[model samples]
Target: MDGSDQGLECLRLLNEIIADFDELLKEDRFRGIDKIKTVGSTYMAVVGLIPEYKIQPNDPNSVRRHMTALIEYVKAMRHSLQEINSHSYNNFMLRVGKSAFN
Candidate 1:
């Protein structure tokens, strides 16, 4: 295998990792979550972006629900990354930062 082959292999592995993340967005639990974009290996998503899932200003429960969903999604992403790491024999770490804004 030459340099180009190794590069292709890396891209293939990255595609696999990204595809796994994309599949998570399709799950019912993550229905309202939207994939914003990916910067290199970073996966960006947002919750309550859809009108139906938007948080209600007067409803505290709505805010809690969205926050809960976001945490669960983050956990799922970490789990997915672990599975991918196991299969690829690569160690990948996830760093999560979350915030809620009006």
Candidate 2:
């Protein structure tokens, strides 16, 4: 494909991916994670920020549970993004950055 054609194809794929993200965010599965804002092409989220972080450093069980939940959430999100890329036949990669505070 030519330059313009490639650009158009990417745009089309992006539109579809955005729609998928919108639907995913509306689901109840990701209740704790809140969508802060989309900066440029990045989607930012906070896991238990307003209500304070639930994991306590002293409690190993609490920390383990929260960590497990975060891992599951990230895996699900990554799978969804990978599915979108596969369906679109595009090699779009997602870069995720995570930070946790006690």
Candidate 3:
């Protein structure tokens, strides 16, 4: 399917997953990956398309950015779930196949 279709699917799935974590998060006891893992992966997939970077050999920056983004998204996911904060995971925006930012 096209990116739009896939993106919509992702949002739908994200909402479902987020809802499932409603209780675990309400008490601030968020745990496990089943519900949150897929959402993180989906975030990577969507961002990796153009502005997102992925981990690759000999690309420390890329890997670094990817990990950062992963972390931010994980944070954002929790924030939205608990109504705590907001983030776009921009920390992961890295240029692939390049070692420098310019």
**Top candidate, metric lDDT:** 1
Cα lDDT tens digits, model 3, 42-75, are: 4222223232233464888766665566455466
Candidate 2 lDDT over residue span 19-73, tens digit each? 6665665666555566687665677766655365544668988667666655666
Better of 1 and 2 by lDDT: 1
Q: Rate the local accuracy (lDDT) of all candidates.
A: 0.85, 0.68, 0.43
Which one wins by lDDT: 2 or 3?
A: 2
The residue-level lDDT of candidate 1 at 30 comes to: 85
lDDT of model 2, residue 78: 76
CA RMSD of all predictions: 1.5, 3.1, 14.7
Q: Could you estimate the TM-score for every candidate? A: 0.88, 0.66, 0.34
Better candidate by TM-score, 1 or 2: 1
True lDDT of residue 74, candidate 3: 61
**Which tens-of-lDDT digit does each residue in 17-87 have in candidate 1?**
78988998888988878888998877888888888888777899987887788888889989998998898
- Misplaced by over 4 Å in model 1 are 99-102
Q: How many angstroms is residue 84 displaced in model 2 relative to the true structure, after the best TM-score fit?
A: 1.8
Off by over 4 Å in 3: 1-54, 84-102
For TM-score, the strongest prediction is 1
Question: Can you list the residue pairs that collide in candidate 3?
Answer: none
